[model samples]
Target: MRSSTRFERDAFGPVEIAADRYWGAQTQRALGVFDIGEERFPSCLIHAFGLQKMAAARANLRCGALDPVLAEPVVAAASELRDGRFDAHFPLTIWQTGSGTQTNMNANEVIANRANEMLGQPLGSKFPVHPNDHVNASQSSNDSFPTVMHLVTVLELEERLKPSLVLLQESLRERANAFANVLKIARTHLMDAVPMTMGQAFDTFARQVAHGFDRIDATMPRLLSLPQGGTAAGTGLNAPPGFDVFFCEEIRALTGRNFSPNPSKFEGMAAHDALVEVSGALNVIATSLIKMANDLRWLGSGPRCGLGELKIPDDGLTSSIMPGKRNPTIAEVLAQACMQVVGNHATITMANASGNFELNVAKPVLIANLLQSIRVLADASRVFAQRLVQDVEVNGAQLARNVENALLLVTALNPILGYDKVAQITAAALEQGVTPRAAALSLGLLDEATYDRVVDARTLAGRPGHRPEGFSERS
Candidate 1:
């Protein structure tokens, strides 16, 4: 018989795998049947799982269930995994793994095998401690998976999203300051209204992002409230007296994860309101991003045919067939990411409803979707800010041209010319191909110098009490 067959025959029951394969026949069949590519779950999630195992192993040591011989290796493996060292061991196909049992066992077997190797033992041999009894001593997937999800999400938010949000806010503030002096016609309901400074419009964008960041940060405290210490059924069955508190503390120490005992372990295991809150928060931020990106897209629409107020960098062709075409692809991506976040939130909501008394079987789906939302929001925020917003050039000439062309600037003149005369001058300016000032002068509504002084966009956009020299408020 082949060495692989002999090895399998000695170690396992009638089932066996070929010598060339590390996994058994079941894994081989799963690999073939699912044939899913190397696309495993996020590496961060896998790292989180490893961190949980390490934390649990350390907790077990504190509980007198594991010796340093075993605990040391677990901690080392976890540290390596967290630093992105062992990626090959994480390629378990997601489809064939019913109930994620294969994945759980895979993690166990990988860690055990690695620990054994560290102890100068052959691979595939359970050493001084077993993978299940010692390493996963007091935990179940019901507890561990969700805990990992929470840890990864919270860490990503703090480490990645928070900084990116600050950068975006800074970018917006810079734009607001740069455009502080430019004036543009304000529109309500897509119709012309009074005048406002371009600074105000940019400031509004900054305020929207700031509010989203605040809301996201505000939601962090809720996320820190975790579902740890809830063992199989939240009863802490088979767990030592102080295991919950001590384990949470150990987790905090090891992973820098500040987890607390679920106030009601029963409710915690039986439901996922925390995940719902997270999803809701992500949806809110995604909605904000949609609004902000759409605003940029519309504001930067056209140099010739559209709004043409701001110009965006040309990253890609807007249309494949249209000549000289460039579209707001980045903004479009933000819109799509926002839609995905909304859909992911809906998925989380549905998954949250799937829990029974003791456990929610839809955990995999919830974690998957929730992580999707986090990654898409984080990545899209970074790209939209860096690629599109930061380097974009403002079309000051076009802005001035449009402002000068706008008949709405004449609204201020309405106070001087009466509404009828202002409307007539507006029409004549359009028809006679002259400046509103020249048209007003032709019609004797006002002199050239006075019209110029009073119709000044900057003076009008100034504070209510402020005006240019020789210009007085009508009221």
Candidate 2:
């Protein structure tokens, strides 16, 4: 039954390989052992590994560890992988060996076979470019794998996630400035508290997102440090001199982002604290998004039922039974996405703590969650900003009515009418279900003219010695 299959061998012994593919025996063994999940290392990770392998081959050649004849084709093959040519070849799951040994070997075999093909040799020749002796020469899964992790994470943060956050922040800021004239009653404990401009409320959300940007910036210096020369257990053993430096140089060239070698390979290989720090920043961002999203839901709720202080775009989502109903589906999406990010952050934190003396047994999950957090936050921010923030319409008349009915405007009345009188008026209004202004007038706290000037929401929010629109203070 096994007679027709092609055989490949590793140091372990002979094995079967996919007939048309380039990967060798070790990758095949990993595929057979660990097919538990559908989650594969992303193509971004594969591309970074290619970049690393290509750079490693050149560094080995320069350091006199690999022959130039092998180096050329390896470089070519590695370049193709880096350029995303063989992304489909990286089929190993994220559920593989903790150090990502299987993924590393997968890269090695794919690059080797491809390199040998470029040299007019058969796929498994292992001649001009042996997967281990040449392409992975001077590196181990410990150094190479984590270096790729850092590369993809750093690039994604700068290229996509960070920029998306800034975009969302700017969009919120623009709306904040535009909404300054639109007044609303602020809520505390779900009750009307005081007068705050719509602009002020939007600005608060912008400030929260801006703070998240600052938090992430603080983690960059550590996140950009590569563990490339650490080799197996951080001992730089087989990795030749200049490998770390060259790897950093190559990284800078490819990404246009600055990176440096880890000062201690042992520290780099043994722990994943940098990624944990990133997850913490992402956790804060998730909370910020949750606040903003929930606030929008409250503001946009009930065109006829709840607390509809603002109008959101009816993105055509209708209740199954009620054809006229449009719900806050995008806000719900943001909330659900934020919850996922929070959960993933917890996973990453545990993964960070799960490391033993030498290496984190959960580096794969740690980076996986970290990257997921970045991408989800970035996406939610973009969608919320465009669909929700940009289109949000303040129900100014309703806000004004709520402000007039709120007993808390007694806060403004206190300084003018004295605390005892204002307190008496507030209790009287609440007990009688009367408006605070009416209660004050009935109690003879002030004449109608004085009450009008002193208790106006516009005056309370805008100026110290303010008058109504037509009042003459001198008269």
Candidate 3:
């Protein structure tokens, strides 16, 4: 090959970096801008992405698209990145480059650049393993990005979210068991109206969370499907034949994950339904989280001015100016975190629908949003279980007091004292500011022995005990 005289000379001088640890000016600038408060792009996501590329390269090699020597370094570099040894190579700022193109190029250059250094080749030289031709062989961001997204979502859901969700359900179940013996007033419209056990309320929450977990489980198979060997377009035109099948199989082996090739190349690269589906799964989770957290806030509301059934950890300062003040900050944070996930889902929903025939221009936003929902939900669920569910105490004394004072418990009397007499007793108790028991006794609705036995919280909450043959509990 002859050197091209048409090659532009003076393409500008070499770039300089002031920071010793940073990779490039673009990466450094990115680091400054998208500092939206996350400490780092999670190492798990990075590892999954690197492993994905390795799988693609290995597949390409098996198909005989590249020389063995070139494939060796590509595999080696990808393996290092997967194992977290090449952190500096992954230096693109989260905000730096749109389409994640800069970040993808950064990975290629760093891997190739490092491999060359190992081979005693001059830096910036692209020989033996060109970054684009060899390291990135038979793959493009078009396929690799979504493939990695699916892989990461599946990994996180299986490894992190599922276990924590089980624990959350168990926490609620335990609370339900503990509260089963405590009879309480069930309220509707914020007004007490009937008799129910605290156990039933807690049990309902546990069941709802379990349903959310089911939704996540249902969404996993779609996420495990990858689009990797499709290359620049969905046609797989640039990818060697057999590349897709081999890549999927190798990934399943390397990562111990069951991934399959997407059946429709055109569908895979044409749009990102996999991402949307997973996002929808996560949104379901966020919806559950919001419901659980809000219920906790309401149930734990007040010692003097609120429901005050359960206690929440005092993690925030309610008032800077007032002394001895605490707030339900953990629950508040959980709610806000769920809200953020909901917002991310909205963005993903829009992005998924916004794509053109060949590709969606909104990929960067899609990836960012998908990642945000995964991480936030994972962390928030763990925190909620540990801080709010596990550590908080139940105000059993308050529960008893509320149950005792509630006129609504008198509804149980309707079944025993007859509806008309029960109504009279409730009205009298309210007017006189006296106990329902006292009112019932005064009204001659029932004899003292019968009223005491049947109206007690234990009997009312349980199987609504049998009355002697002569007297009916149902009147």
Candidate 4:
């Protein structure tokens, strides 16, 4: 029978590796040492590393640091890695060496072994495609890991998160148009305040999402600045001259992104302020999402006892014992997702702050948290738009009822009756448990004709003749 494990040696010593695995000795050691968490780096991150390695190989070849013979197989192996052919080989958790050196070496070893196998050599034979000398040529984990972080951040934001935000913004705008004339009672500090249209509320949400897109767009320039050629420190000691420029050119070719070398590699390697800034943007988005979700939950509170101004979609989720309990499951889920993003931002903030003198050792955790925030926020935003926003039914009867009975509508009488008199009318309405109109008449505040003329809810919603800009007049 064939052996299940084989021996491979690194700078430290020999270690046993699975015979079928592409990773070598160092990866085997990391698998044993950093067994702390189940949080392996996501497939997107691994794929990004593949792209990074492939770009490095092409850059090295362009700079004449690697011969064409070795470069060919290395490029092929790294491309395969980027394309996810060797996904199972990368098994290290995010809790590994904070510099992500082990993960970098994992990529190196995997690509080197695969390249060697392609060259008709055995797995452990590091002959032509040495992991460090060729596969990791002119690159350091400190620089390469941060470069991959930036690459993945840009790709995730542009490809996933921004599109999702656009979808949500458009969805909200559509809802705003649909409800343009549906006047409802507005609340401040959870108490009835005045009148507004449901369209105005949804338009506010759409504007918030549009601003989220702008924030991410503003963050992209910083994210696109890479530090790949700064090798071990920010000095570019062993890297060939112009390697940074060539590496960026190769990266642009691979990703079609405008990746450029950071002017100050030291800042890129030592501080993750750019990533923290992105996280702060995400934090703001999470806050906005939480606000919108909470608003929906409150607006959809109950069909009989609560606010009941908005009808949440029935996604078939139910309580175990309740016969027909329909919960605001989508909004609740979206709120929970945003809450997790908030927590992830906290972790990312702390991790970014932990950077010391030369290099940030918290790279793995920082990138992991940032990627998780982007992924979950993107997915939740899309789901919230498609599943909830598109299907939510406005409770028009309840909205009209609330608007008609709201005591705060007395503000419309303030111009003629004055603030103090309006306050008395509101107080009397509350204390006597009557409508504001009834209380105003009881107090002889004004004639019913003037009150009715001024307190029209539709007119009180906004400026005269305002109809949500792009919406048509109510039929």
- Candidate 2 clashes between residue pairs 3 or more apart in a chain or in different chains: none
Report the C-alpha lDDT of model 4 over 160-229, residue by residue, as the tens digit.
9988888888888889888888998888888888898898898888878877877887898999999999
Better of 1 and 2 by TM-score: 2
Q: Model 2 Cα displacement at 79 (Å)? A: 2.2
lDDT string for model 2 (1-475, tens) is 5344567788999987766688889998888898798887667788888888877787787788888888888889989998989987877778988888888998999999998999898777787678888888899998888888888888778877877887788877777777776777788888778777787788778778777878988999998898889898888997878988887887787778788999998888889889888888888989889988899898988887777788888787798998798888888898888999999988988988887887877878777777787788878878887887788887877777777788877788777868888899999999999998889889987888887777777656663222235321110
Candidate 2: where are CA atoms >4 Å away? 1-5, 462-475
Model 1, position 9, has a per-residue lDDT of: 20
Which candidate number has the best TM-score? 4
Q: Lowest summed-lDDT stretch of 10 residues in model 4? A: 466-475
- Please list all clashing residue pairs in model 1, or write none if there are none: 4-19, 318-327
In angstroms, the error of model 2 at 130 is: 1.0
Off by over 4 Å in 4: 463-475
TM-scores for all candidates: the values are: 0.84, 0.93, 0.85, 0.96
**What is the number of residue pairs that collide in model 2?**
0
Per-residue C-alpha lDDT of model 3 across residues 1-475, encoded as one tens digit per residue = 5322111111343443432231333343455656655434466667876787688778988999878777777778788878888675565545533345556655666567566766776445556667777777888877777677678778887778777777777777777777776666777887876666777777766777777777777776777778877777788868898999999999999979889999876676668887888888788878878887887788888767888888787765668797877778888888898899999999998988877777766666777788878777877877887777776667888887877777866777777667888889889999999888889888877888887777776666664322123321110
lDDT of 1 by residue, 360-414 (tens): 7677667777887888888888888888878776788877776777776777887
Identify the candidate with maximal lDDT.
4
